[model samples]
Target: MRILQIHNFYKQAGGEDTVFEQEAQLLRAHGHTVEQLTFSNNDVTSTKAKLQAALGVVYNPQSAGIISQSIKRFKPDVVHVHNFFPLVSPGVFWVCRKYKVPVVMTLHNYRLLCPSAVLYYDGRVQLENVQQTFPIKPILQGVYRGSKIETASVVLATGVHKLLGTWREKVSKFIALTPGAADLFQNSSLRLRPEQLSIKPNFTADPGLGAATREAYFLYLGRLTEEKGIRTLLKAHSIKPFPLKIIGTGPLQALVEEYAAKNPLVEYLGFRPREEAMEQLKRARALIFPSEWLETFGMTAVEAFATGTPVIASNIGGGAYIVQHQQNGLHFSPADAQELASQVGLLEQLPDLAKKLGQHARQSYEQHYTPEANYARLLQIYGQAIGATEKPASATVAAEAGL
Candidate 1:
C-alpha cells in the first residue's frame, strides 16, 4: 500500500512528532510505500509571519495546492494526518475530499476540542471549553499561549469548521489514543459519531527487560512542566524523602535545580538521550508519572513498562487508563502529594510487590504496546477507512459555505 502522512511540527519536537515518524517507519518496514509532508512552527517566528499564520489558521490555499500536487503525483492509497493546526489547517481535508481519498487523522491531542490542545492551562486541567460551542471562556482567559488574540484565532478556526460540518463529514476516520480519549471526544462539542472514532494507543519499541537488581531511586522522565505535576512530585518527595532522579528539561527547570540543590534525596539529571533515559528506566525501582492533565497517551510510562519497570501514575486521564492499579503498576490520586508519597513508600517497603508489578508491566507491554500489535491494528483501521464510501466533491457547497 502507498500512504501519504502529513504533519505540522511545533517549534519544539514532541510525542506527536515522534509517533508520526515511528508509524511511518513502521509502515515502510512492513513493505508499504510511505511519503511525508511537514510544516514547522520555526518558520512562524517573526511578527508578520505570526500574523499571517493566525489569519490562515482556518484555511491555507498554499497548503491545499501542495497537497493536491502530492496527491496527483503519489496516488497514495490513503492520506494519514497527524497534526494540522496553524499552517496546514482543515482545508486539506476538503482537498482530499475533492480527490476522493480516505483521510485518517490521529487525535494526538485535543486541538479540535480545546485550543490549548491538552485540556489544561493555568496550572490545572481546564475543561471549561470542552462543551462550549465557541469556548468563550478560554478565549477570554487567553488559554492558548497566554495570548487572547492567538486563542481567539484557534477558536475561530475550529468554530468555523465545526459550523461547516468539516469534522463530521469530511474525514474518513479519527484515531483516539485511548478509550477514555475516545469517550471525551465523543461527548465534546465536536460530537463525533461512534463509528468515526477508533481507539489506538501509541506503541514503543521494546528496550528489553531491565536488570534483576533495581536501583534505590524512583524515576521521573518527562518535561518538567506544572501540568506534568512536577510540583506535586516535589511535594511528595518532601512528604516522604526517597531517592528521586528526574530526567528532562522544561519551563520548571530552575525550580527543579533549586529543589535538587536543597534536597539530598533528589537528583536532577537534565535532558539525556533516549538510550540513557531507557537505561535509567531499566534500573529504577519504578517510574513516577504524576501528570495533572488529561494526557492523550503517556509514552514515557509505556517505555517504562517495556523496560520491565512498573509505573506509579496519577489516577486520571491516560495514566489511569494505562496503569492497572496493584496489577501492572500502582495509581495515586491526581495532585495528591500525601498519597503519592505513600505509594512511593509502599514500593520501597514491599520489594516483592514491586517485583510482581514489574513482571506484569513487561507482560502488558508485550500484549498491548508492541510494534507487531500496533501494525495489525493500523492495517485494520486503514482497511476500514478504505472500505467506507467516499463523499463526492461539492464545489457549490464549498463556495456557498466559504470553507
Candidate 2:
C-alpha cells in the first residue's frame, strides 16, 4: 500500500508528532511505501509572519493548495492526516475531496471542537468549557488575552470551522487514541461514523524496559507545566511516607525546585533521556500522573503501564481512561495533595497489593497496548476505509487517476 502521511506540527514537539513519526516508521518497516509531508508553525519568521500564521490557523487556502499538489504528486491510496492547526487547516481534507481520494484522520486532540485545545481557563481546566453553553467562551478569551478583538479573531478561526461543517467533509474514518476520547467525540456534534471510528492508543519504542522488576519509589514523568500539576505532586511529596522522583522540566521548574528544597521526600532529578526515564518507570513503585487539565491522552501513563508499573493518576481528564480505578491502578482527585499523599502512602503499606496492581497493569499493556496489536487494528481500519471488503485489496490495480 502507498501511504501519504500529513502533519502540521506545533512549535513544541509533542506526543502527536512522536506518534506520527512512529506510525510512519511502522508502515515503512512493514514494507508499505510511505511518503511524508510536514508543515511546521516554526516557519513564521517575524511579527507580520506570526500574524499571518495566526490567521492561517483559522483557515489557510495556501495550505490547501500545497496539500492538493502533494496528493496529485504522490497518488497515494489514501491520505492520513495527523494535525492541522495554526496552519494547514481542515482544508487538506477538502483538498482530498477534490481528488475523490479517501481520507483517514486521527483525532490527536480536541482542536476541532475546542479553540484552546486544552480546554483551560485562568491557568486551570475550565470544566464548564467542555460543554460550552454560550458566546461567553469568546467573551472570556477576549478578556483573557487583554483585548476583545485579538481573542475574538482567534476564536472566530476555530468557530468558523465548526460552523461550516469542515470537520465532517468527505472523511472516511476517524482514529481516536482512547475509547474515552471516542466516547466524547460520539457525544459531540462533530461525531464520526460509529463503524468507521477506531481506537488505537499511542505506543512507546520497544527497548524492553518493562521487563525489569519494579522497586519502591513513585515516579512523575512529563512536562512540569501548570496543567501537569507538578506543584500539587511536590506538595504531596511532603506528606508522603513513600519517596516521589520527579523527571522532566518545563516552565514550572523553579517552582518545583523551591518546593523540593523544603520537602525532603521530593527528589527533583531534572530531565532525563527517554531510555533513562523508561528505566526509572521500570524500577518505580508506580508512576504518578497528577494532571490538572483534560489531557487528550496521558502518554506517560501508558509508558508506566508498559514498564509493569501501575500508575497512580488523577481520576480526571484523559489520565482517567488509561489508569482504571482499582483494577490496573489507583486514582486520586487532580491537584489534591492529601488524596495523592494518601494513595502513594497506601502503596508502601500494601506492598503485595501494589505488586498485584502493577502486574495487572502490565497485563493490560500486553492485552491492549502493544505495537503489533495496534498495527493489526490499524490495518483493519485502513482496509475498511478504502472500501476493501476483506483484509487486502484482493487485486493490484492502479486507480483511475493518481491521488
Candidate 3:
C-alpha cells in the first residue's frame, strides 16, 4: 500500500516526532510504499512569522494546497497525519476530502480538546476545558505556552473546526493510543463517534530481556518536567532514600541537579543515547513512571517492559492503563509521595516478587508492544479507513470549504 504521512514537528523533538518516524519505518520495513511531508516549528522564528502562524492556526490554505499537490502526484492509498497543530492546521483534512482520499489521524495528544494538549498546566491536570466548546478558561489563563495570545489561537482553531464538524466528518478514522485516551476524547467536546475512534497503543522494538541479576537502584526515564511527576519522584525519594537513577533533561534540570547533589543515593544522568538508556533499564530493579497528567501513552514504561523490568507507575492516565498493579507491575496514587515510597520499599524488600513482576512485564511486552503485533493492528486500521464509505455531512463540508 502507498501511504502519505504528514507531521508538524515541534522546535524540540519529542515522542510524537519519534513515533511518526518509527511508524513510517515500520510500514516501509513491511514492504509498504511511504512518503512524508513534514513542517517544523523551528521555522516559526521571527515576530512576523509567529503572527502569520497564529493567523493560520485555524486553517492554512498554503498547507492545504501542498497536500492537494502531493495527493495528486503521489496517489497514495491513504493519508496518515500524526500532528498538524499551529502549522498544517485542519485544512489538510478538507484537502483530502476534496481529492476523495481517506485520512487517518493519530491522536498523539489532546490538542483538539485542550489548549495545552496534555490536559495539564499550572502545576496540575486542568480539565476545565475538556467539556467547553470555546475553552474560555484555558484561554483566559493562558494555559498554552504561558501566553494568552498563543492559547487563544489554539482554542480558536480547535473551536472553529469543532463548530464546522471538521473533526467528526473530514477524517476517516482517529487512532487513540490507549483505551483511556479513547474514552477521554469520546467524552470531550470533540464528541467523536465510537466508530470513528480506534485504540492502538504505541510499540517499540524489543530490546531483549535484561540480565538475571538486577541492579539495586530504581530507574526514572523521561523528561524532567513537573507534569512528568519529577517533583513527586524526588519527594518520594526524600521520604525513603533509595538508590535512584534519573535519565532525561527538561525545564526542571536544575532542581534534579540540586537533589542529586544533596542525596547520596540519587544519581542524575543527563540525557543519554537510546542504547545506554536501554542498558540502564535492563539492569534496574524497576522503572518508576510518576507522570501526573493524562499521558496519551507511556513509551518509556513500555520500553522498560521490553527490557524485562517491571514498572511502578502512578495510578493515573496511561500509567494506570499500561501497568497492571501487582501483576506485571505496581501502581500508586498519583502525586502521593508516601505511597510511591512505600511501593519502592516493597520492591526492595521482596526481591522474588520483583523478579516475578519483571518476568510478567517481559511477557506483556511480547504480547502487546512488539513490532509484529503493532504492524497487524496498523494494517487493520488502514484497511478500515480505506473501506469507509460514509459520505461526509454536506453542510460540514461546505462550511470547511468556505474557510
For residues 156-215, write the lDDT of model 2, one tens digit per residue. Answer: 665666666665545777787777777766666564445556676777655454544556
Worst 10 residues of 3 by lDDT: 394-403
Q: In angstroms, give how far residue 165 of model 2 lies from its true place.
A: 1.5
Clash count list over all predictions: 0, 1, 0
For model 2, the stretches where C-alpha displacement exceeds 4 angstroms are 127-135, 142-151, 191-196, 209-213, 388-403
**Each prediction's whole-model lDDT (CA):** 0.90, 0.75, 0.90
The TM-score measured for candidate 2 stands at 0.88
CA deviation > 4 Å runs, candidate 1? 390-403
lDDT of 2: 0.75
Backbone clashes in model 1: 0
Candidate order (lDDT): 3, 1, 2
Tens-place lDDT per residue, model 3, 214-248, is 98999999998889999999999998999999999
lDDT of 1 by residue, 249-308 (tens): 999999999999999989999999999999999999999999999999999999999999
Poorly placed runs, candidate 3 (over 4 Å): 390-403
